[model samples]
Target: MLARVKLEKGCKSRGIKLSGALAAAGLIAAHSTKDLSDHQREKYAVVTLIDCRSILDPVLSSDYMGFYHSAILNTHDVSGGENLWDLAKRCYTAYSNAKNNNKHFTDMGDLNFLMCKAIENPGLTPSSSLRTAFISVFEDPVTDDTNEMHGEVGVEDYVGCSSVHGVGPSVAIFDTIRDGRLDCACVYPSPLHSRDQMQKLIDDMKKILVDGCANGESES
Candidate 1:
């Protein structure tokens, strides 16, 4: 159930496609009340932090990469009080890049833009099946309007999906950290690369998505 989306020229596009890690430098960053201390911050120092000022250049800015790097440099950044504009801009960039680069972009609409479009779709009911599907596919409650989903409410399981599927170089990097098969605990905090691990992730995800679709059809 990984959903990927892209943003371009202020427009957001969506795709039902595939589908993170890192350490912190501060002692507090290394270990949080909810996270583990086993992953060393030094392992993630390579991640870069995004600047808030990079919001204007949607086309060429590397903010999306910066956002992913920020996640690893300090996964704790999920709640570090960054501004909404910065996060939203980064999300837009990430989604756009993902759509352009990943094969998963086919047959998908942009969730970010679709939300507003839905609001204007008089022919569609908010409770209609299509609306529900659109929201389910792209409007991640775990990710805010800015589309950042790191430590957001009810979204620990989604961090991996959001990182890759959102838009940006982070998608590939997150997959690497996932190293593939993430257990339900979803505790691994860095990019994963083991062949066995990736195979497992892909298999598990395919099963989940396929079964969900079947169940939805049966219910209808």
Candidate 2:
């Protein structure tokens, strides 16, 4: 339902700063398909869901019983050697453009119509599986999770996420910043992507983030 990420020692390139969701989304999509080599570029669509609670006309509270989120979809060409910062900037810019134009509010009806059409006729979606985007992230999380709160609640290691079993992206990222660390819950369809595959992808993404922080830029 929501996502959050941590940025350390922000790096600005072309005056565009990188955020956690954009950077992670681009990198995941770029490295998604192993079939493409570093020389080849592939197009990947990312759907970012923004919580509309505060932005809604009526202004809903966090305790609102229903889903009050909107999605903004964007596509980018990615390569195996894609720079995380550059790709993140592109993603951010696209989202900003869409958000600035009120696409989230304007495009909701269109998206719903398309979703209904897809549901009525699976052939409208890729592989007739209802997969709309390659990846999905949250624009901003409503709350920040903390380890102290978890301890008081007697909660141990856990992953809070939304299931993408019906109609959604191939991978859904539920990211949260906890105790200054980024914790992500990745949900992918079963049998389509193996545990090993997702594990490798997660490892690669973490390495990119770590390296970016260490070197103050993305290595790949």
Candidate 3:
């Protein structure tokens, strides 16, 4: 998901993707309380989903769909106050390494086993809540706007979402771009994670993003 930079564009700069590690880093930093000692590092996990249609050996058309998205899990150790760009680079580096090694496919068996075990033994997850990861994002965003087909159906706008009240990450983000605007639908298990908590987390995330951009300072 770390797809912001194009080396060909001579962007000797770290990039952040809409559905990539940059988003995860922002969330992790937001979850870090100010009271946390600078020396303390918290471990956070994130999952990025990748569509296999274009990546398949024999690439298939987008119309041909059958649960083709695969996931790559990454764990980051955050000690708070880390530079956003540096953290983003680190997150991307880990994901890229794993993808290069084909961990998505190779780790499927183990992932399934762990999933089954988590279902059987809720204690395997946080608070025995079946919480597998902190966040889940897609590697790429789906882009579109209502077209002639939609005009016939009288569809002005639409959104895609799913029920994550069962076993899943704390936040599942489905991002899309329409008419050049990025929009995301987020789902989380309620009661388990109260609305206030998630709202505060999101507010803090926005602050972090705004501050990062406003300051315009990062590790070189």
Candidate 4:
């Protein structure tokens, strides 16, 4: 709880949202993949799924959930031995700048055009082996208004609040907050990667977030 508060404060100081901070942490933790062979590490990319409903239309309220979201792709040279905080700030800055420029909306047409081309040329689609790393950060809907629906809920109960499954990424992280506490689930294709390895990566990501919150470092 204390760590959460501190992290939130740090994010506010830097004009970063909690989702952006978590995304940064996920990417930083993903740097550990450098332990793998160079060929394997070269294929690793970070894809952040961000909610765009708020920015889509100013008049539309948060309740208007029309599937307004987009994915931000960020590739890192983890071999450079970059600082975690620095990398995090860069990730957040890129996302912020892109959104501020209204690229999210403008890119929709480009995405459609690319999809059409991919449909014509299926060869353009990446194979399963080329899957990138993915992280999705979201807030659970267990608010005061809907508290009655989740009677007798606890931290552990939040585990069932989210579900993630797909072939697009080798590793996918689903993150959410319930009752002011953060919860995350890391999933990977079983035969492709060992559960123990993925679990360790997830643990490292959590530790990074907690440490960032506890340290109360000023924005760099």
Candidate 5:
């Protein structure tokens, strides 16, 4: 929670959001791994999901409630060692610029067309291989004061629920905050991925966030 708060403040100072910061950190950590060669790193396409409800028209906003987000694919080179703050700024700025230009809505028709073509001709699709995608959802953390049950029930005991399927991407991160703590669940294509490696990746992500927050504080 402390790390999240510090990151939020740091993002606010730079006109970005916490999700963007997380995306930046994750991208850096992902590419920094020694196992991945420069060629492999260059081939990575990091996609950042953005919610578009606020930018839609009032009628469309009220009518649609399902899958209204678009992805901002970052194809820029992240080869060299770069400052987290600068990376975050770039990521946020790209998304911000896209939103400001209404690309989310404007590009919908093209995306639909491409999807139809891909469905008709699977070969036209770039790759069938699945890659891990990172997602972060920072909700208001559950606390005693916010608990509707008051002292009658222990809010800390509550656990969120989710459903996963075998298809789709190889791995995805579902992050949420509860009781002032970050809870991240990595959903992977079971049996295909090593449990130890996935756990280490999660641990590395956490360390990156914590270190980024600490460094931000020291710099401030």
Candidate 6:
């Protein structure tokens, strides 16, 4: 019986190709807006999956994401840190410093210090406006989101793949949002292995944003 089984051998199986899914997902993520002319406007629904319930009052109390409406305020002009990496580094430094010292570093002050230090380097006399812009990048939900799950999103979900590769979630959000979508830079897991996963993230984010807006409206 053993000899017969050996002779039969294992059946050869054709491996399913996931490259196509990955490629399609890449194209979706790479979608551009260069085609839109100056003054061209398109309606985009806002979405955010993180429960920003408390921060909502702080952000909404002001013109949170206010730069979107003004003519002069563009992505590069308003996203305080240089790139995703830079933002991540700043976040890490601030968090570490605060954790070690047991003293809270306010976001705005921490950002301003980061900006000053960034410009203090030789041959990097970037403008105060540029530094200020970096200091004003959008805030993330301070509440823990590692356990909540809605539409394939959990706390671990907000932590994007880049974070696994040593890239913090802040930077991922920075890079992703630079594409012009107001809702692009999110601090959440976005396993972009397939279009379906991407869509799930987007849908989940929209749900959160809608819910937050409703709550805000009701509170008012």
TM-score of each: 0.21, 0.82, 0.82, 0.70, 0.71, 0.23
Question: Which scores higher on lDDT, 4 or 6?
Answer: 4
Rank candidates, TM-score, best first.
3, 2, 5, 4, 6, 1
lDDT of 6 by residue, 1-220 (tens): 3321211121001121111111112222222212544344332111111223334434543324323211011121112112222222333343334434533323436544654565564234332222222111222312222243443553233332122321112112322221122223333333423456545645543443344334434543
lDDT of 5 by residue, 86-136 (tens): 877877677678767877677768755754565566555345323323333
Q: What is the lDDT of residue 134 in candidate 6?
A: 13
For 122-198, candidate 3 gives per-residue lDDT tens digits of 99898898989888888777776655578799987678866534567887878776565556677778778888887
Worst 10 residues of 6 by lDDT: 69-78
lDDT per residue for candidate 4 within 1-220, as digits (tens), equals 5666777777777776666676667766776656754334332355566566655546566667566567655555543344556666766777667767766667768755764665566456565332434554442222223434567464224343333343345565665555565555666766667888778777877888777765556533
Q: Model 3: residues >4 Å from true position, as ranges?
A: 1-12, 147-157, 163-165, 217-220
The segments of candidate 1 whose C-alpha lies over 4 angstroms from its true place after superposition are 1-55, 58-193
Pairs with steric clashes in candidate 5: none
Error of 5 at 40 (Å): 9.5
Tens digit per residue, CA lDDT, model 1, 112-184: 3554555566246333322212111121112223323434655444453433222122112222223223222
Off by over 4 Å in 6: 1-171, 175-193
Q: What is candidate 5's CA lDDT for residue 37?
A: 54
lDDT of 1 at 117: 58
Shift of residue 155 alpha carbon in model 3, Å: 3.9
What overall lDDT goes with each candidate model? 0.29, 0.68, 0.69, 0.59, 0.59, 0.28
